[model samples]
Target: MLSYGFWNNKGGTGKTSLCFQSICFYAHQHPEERILVIDVCPQANLSELLLGGLANGGSDRLLARQGAVPRATIGGYFQQRLPSPYQPPAIEPLDYITTPCEYNDEIPENVDLICGDPLLELQANAISTLANNNIPGTDSWIAIIDWIKDLLQPLSGKYDVAFIDCNPSFSIYTQIALSTVDRMVLPVMADDSSRRAIQNAFSLVYGLKLPSDIYATYAFATRLRNANRTLPKVHMIVKNRLTQYMGKASAYAAVLRSIDRDIEKLMDSNPEIFTFEALNDGIVDVRDFQTTGVVAFAKGTPLYSLKTGKRDVMGQRVTVHEDYKANCVEHMNDLVGQL
Candidate 1:
């Protein structure tokens, strides 16, 4: 399957929300293709949105999945894999899959989900230990990293495309989640820290311009390359939460331009690690979703499914301006068009 991952080392970058909306729009636009979404974040916010957001009983539904006999979540799949860290299990991969549209009518009919779980936080330490284990005749690290890949083995040719939502940290779970992606869609805000986060992402994923020679030996790129594995190329960068302001003289304009310049310099030096040679070809500027985003996310609804004006969200009347709603859909359409 052609897979894309939405990730950034920084939080508050609107990564999950963007993934939720873009995937929904994509699923709605292409009704013939079966879509899959894997939520690897411990918070599982994306899962909640998929199942039914706060207005609906999403948390309750998620809890039911988490408490199932097989656990019925990614953590449950991890529970199966922990006992056989170095080998694939005999269990069914589709058993862990849940169709979101079955629970929430707002979702497109073709979408399926592997629910994220809070159990991930508890299992992270033990999983890390398993990865670093010194097992004879088996590469513990690669096997651990491939847990998700192995799980998806039976799903080969089953899905037209897949999207993974990762946590902000470089934890063991995040490492496993990222190993399956062919293209990386990084989201960043208009700030200096985002610039640093982009540089950090490059260093963490591709081992570009690592600070010292000693670190190269223990870097992610080092280990993956040693195992003859490939790193996902940077396909596109989404500048999320850009405030609509007074043209190029806005307060965030300078920060955004600096980030672009930094990326362009990196493109010049590490052309092999990016899908696009030019920065403009790979960058998408999205205005803040604002009221439309708040309402859409609150009810587990996609932008395209939203009607302007007052919308009921759990007995609360939330006003969704028509202009704002249309703006959200337009931005999402633009982002999906890139895919």
Candidate 2:
């Protein structure tokens, strides 16, 4: 399967919301294909958004209280002993998947979720410790870092696309997700903080040491002006949550220009990893659909699915206008098309 990670070291850039929307849009557009989402964030916000009460507590409570049941979570998979690089773990990805039918009988079975666990934070630290102490030639670090990739090997042909949502930190969990993804999507808001976060992300990626031969190939690509090979290429640098008003857009022009200049500088220094053409081709600007976003979150549904009229959300009554919902759907469709 083609895997993509929606992440940024900076939080509150709408990473989870965008990731959720992409998965839902892709699943709806391709009903015949299977789509999977793995929530690696300790907060489990995406899991809670997608699965609702079942993610935090519901059926799991009854199952645990009634009898012994396996902990069906991404973190639970890492609790076992670390395997050698030559040996793959005997774990089934399907066992941990939570289907839509599990949450509600009326929902379709197109998308599945590998729920996240708060305990993953602890597991990440342990893995980091093991990786830090491993000898250079032992290949143990590869196995440790490639744990998620190996875990998903069995499902490579089963799903069309797998989207991973990671925490806004450089923990071992984030590294595992980064190492496994074919494409990386960086969601950045129109602000100064997001710009600094982008710079930090590039520095971290550049510091990572891969195998010598792979590193050599990457170095060689840097010399070739037309080369297009890079590990986990930045598929897009999404300019998210832009204001709808022209005045605000004019005010943000300087910040956007600054970000562009910074990206250009990075490209000049690291052509192999970041290219001018790639940056230009991957940049996308999306507007902030405030009303639609609030309604979607409150109703526990995608923005496109919001209906008109009054509805109860989290014990509060709210009204959704038809024009607003229609506008949100249009923007969402355009966003998905850009992806």
Candidate 3:
């Protein structure tokens, strides 16, 4: 399966929102293809949003409440096997897979979820310990990293695409998630904090010790100037939560220019590591659909599926404007096209 991770060290960048929209659009575009969404965030916001709500509990609660046979979460897999580092057990992706649509017709059937759990926070430390451990005649840190990768190996031919929504931090879980993905989708806002978040993400990738085999391939690449190696190709740098209004056109343009300059400076500083050009056409700007997004999330429906009508919002009846719905669809299509 082709895996893509939507990540940013900084939160509130609409990372999860973009991931949700992208996967939904992908599934809608290719109904025959199986798509898996693994939520590796401790907050489980993506899990809750995609699965409808926390009340519509899935494998995470199934495993926790009933003490199910096989642990049914990404964190649970590591929590169960990290203790036996010398001989880690195998984990099947299907065992943890939860068909949210099967339970609720409102959801897309082609999309499956590996629900996230708050327990992942606890497992993060254990995974780090195992990764740093140097036990004689035992498994190496690379083995531990591979163990996490193995969890998703069974999904190779089963799904067409896998979208991973990671935590907004550089933890062992994030590292494992990053290692497995073929492409990284960075969602950043047009602001200073977002710029710093991008820098931090690049720094994190530079510091990480990827598999020796992978590292060997980039050893001779001239683009990577420093001792720190590069990372997987950044598929796109998305500018999320953009506000497009004629009233503030100049102001917004200035912000975009600022963001552009920040990206240029970043590439200049780390030429070898960030050789991927940040072209004007390459960076997608997803306009802010404030209330539209809220309605979509609340209804657990794709923005494209939303119709022009009145909908109840927290006991308040509100009209869903046709123009707003069209804008959302336009943006979604644009994002999918860019991808």
Candidate 4:
């Protein structure tokens, strides 16, 4: 199975949201029938999307909100003892559940999700304890990943893809994710600030000395509009509250093309450098996901329809894909092709 992670340090960039959509896309499309979503983000948005609620009520949410204690999450999976093959829990752990179908009956049958606890942020201190030779719990970090690998081993040939949604920071949890992931995708916006975030993400990947195959990215440029000629040329742009500041098409595309050319130059200047795409609006349509996992599930039904292709360059009314949904699918298809 292919293990992929959708990551970016900065928030509000739609990292978890896109990850959820990709899981849905593949679950419906891939037939070999092996898929698992590991939600490492404390935000638990992906987890909630899959399971429909946070584990242990909203306690996890409260803890993450306060940043008080890192939840004894996957850390417990490392140290927490499990029943042996010969024991009661048997081949699979107890937390696994098969509930009634929410979306397509066939689709949910092929899907299984491991949720993230809000207190997962607490794993940092747990890792520190283990590093200092204090194995307070059942296992260590190495044990955690091994346990995870073992848990999924049964579904080995059954799965064709695994999507892991990691937290924003470069903490111990992310380290485990990086070491285990077969590939990684970074989603960036079109603005200068998002560009800096991508740079920081690149730094994180390089710092780990992870193989080149494991690090890759796609840029989803959104909320862009054609404005005056004074602004910088960029590859893509997102429309936001400040409509007054967007540039015109001729000027904006010119700026974006400049950025794209600069990136090509950067890659040529450094062979290890990665490649990126400047996709227009492709985010998911929010209305498609009405009241949880229950979707309309109808053909030709727009997936969260939004305004597109209407207004003129100067503050014209335009509707793009809801939120990078299609762009993510396209980018992931390319990544899968690489594997």
Candidate 5:
């Protein structure tokens, strides 16, 4: 299966959110393929999203007695608790049927989720210690990959994609997770700290001796701002006049999120990019822009052609403008093609 990890050193960069939407995107586009969602983060946001809360005991309680459940996680595969009678057999969605979740949505039909318990943080370190002490030929990283191969053994030819949601910081656990994956996608915000995170991400990629042609890497720039602001009319006129003499470079801008004190509207309709300013000002069109989430866009055919505006996929009208829809479609198309 093709593995993808949504990662950034910085937190609250929309890593988990992106992963959830991507799964929805693929499931809507290609419904036949099975998918595996592995939550490698101690926060377990991915797991929580997919599996909901734990049963009886909390997820941590279940993790404390990992051996009790043979098909609980990657660790169980190594211990040979999987449903497969033989070693390294293909993975089956039925393996995770015991996991608890309340998603009646159609997107999860082909998905089989492996929930992450809070105890994963401790389990990772314990495995590291054992590997360093008793394992002669293998390191912890290698062991992680071995576990992945076996855990997914039942799904050998069953899935087209595997999405791993990694924690923000690079831990020994992440080192193992990164070394095993074939491709990685970096989600970056258009700010200074995000740039440094990109640099650190490149360092990690460089350290891994992966094949060149296997999977292409790329950066998706989010949350931008226009540069030409707060200038006087005469200064702005002069700036415009000087533009002819200077070549136009790719102007970078960001949608000011509410989290920033400088940004007045975190979820506003204003086009953060400088280029979008002149086309339409004082009005924000949701269809033409790419906001926090785009999958909620309405899906329908032209009937009597009532312009109720953009609606959620359920065919009910919502307030999303036209610009946001266009940008999201274009961006997602490019991403899927690259994949």
Candidate 6:
């Protein structure tokens, strides 16, 4: 399966929201292709939105999945791998998969999920320790980080594409998911910090422009290269939550241009780090979805499936204007088109 990882070094870029909406849109657009979503973030918000949103008992449904006999979640899969971190295990990947449509009818039938869990917060230390284990000629780090890739190997032909919603941090779980990624979707906001985040993400994932060579041996990119494994190329940089200030004269324009210039510089220096040869083809800007997004996210409904008018969301009334809803749908269509 071709895996697309959604991530950013900095938080508050609306990464998870963009990821959730993008996957739903992608699944709806490509109904013939069986889709899989892996929620690698410990918060599991994407899993909740996938199962059912705030208005539809999403939290309750997620808890039930976490409480399953074998526990059908990413944490569950990790637990199984704990005993055999360095060696391949016989556990079935499908055993850990859940059909989101089963809980939320609004989601497409072709989409499956490996739900995220709160247990991951507790599991991080153990996973980190395992990766750092000094075993003789074992390359324990690589073996530990490739857990997700190993899980997906069994279902090679079953899934056409996979979307992973990653944690903001460079957690071991995120590394596990990124290890399987063919392309990365990085979402950034319009600000100077986001500009720096672009550079930081490249440094973290591809070992580009580090302060010194002293840290090169400890970088994720270095380890991947040493293992003879290719790192994922940045496929799309989604400029998310954009406003009208994106125009040339807008005050935010300078920052936006600076962001573009940074990418342009990266393109000139390390063209191998990206999939697209041109910056325009690789970057996308998404407008703020406004109230339309509020209602859709609250109900865990894809923007395309949402209707205009007021809807009760957990006792609060949300009004989704027709124009706003249409705009959001169009934005989603444009965003997913790049995928």
lDDT of 6 by residue, 51-157 (tens): 88988888899999999968899999999999999998899887889999999999999999999998898999999999999999899999998899889888889
lDDT of candidate 2 over 1-339, digit per residue (tens): 888888899999999888877777777778898888898888876776665333234345323312223566777666654443335657776767777546633234788877777777877767767766657555455556677777887887888888899889878788777777777788898889998888877755554333565554433223122233235666777788877674644757677778878877766676666322656676777677676677675434766666778876656677888887786677667667755
- Candidate 4 wrongly placed segments (more than 4 Å): 53-107, 131-147, 208-266, 269-339
Model 1: what TM-score? 0.98
Give the TM-score of each candidate: 0.98, 0.83, 0.84, 0.57, 0.56, 0.98
**Tens digits of lDDT, candidate 4, 81-125:** 332311112344324322213322323556665556555566565
**Clashing pairs in model 2?**
none
lDDT of each: 0.90, 0.69, 0.72, 0.46, 0.45, 0.90
Give one digit per residue, the lDDT tens place, for model 3 in 250-286: 7656666777786677566655443266566457778
Give candidates' CA RMSD values in order: 1.1, 5.3, 5.1, 12.8, 14.9, 1.1
Measured with C-alpha atoms, the lDDT of residue 79 in candidate 4 is 34
For candidate 5, lDDT tens digit of each residue in 152-195? 65667877888777778766556545544555655655445655
TM-score of 3: 0.84
Q: Looking at model 6, which ten-residue stretch has the lowest summed lDDT?
A: 244-253
**Positional deviation of 278 in candidate 3, in angstroms?**
5.8
Candidate 1 — worst ten consecutive residues by lDDT sum?
243-252
Model 2 worst lDDT run, 10 consecutive residues: 220-229
Model 1 ranges off by over 4 Å: none
Worst 10 residues of 4 by lDDT: 218-227
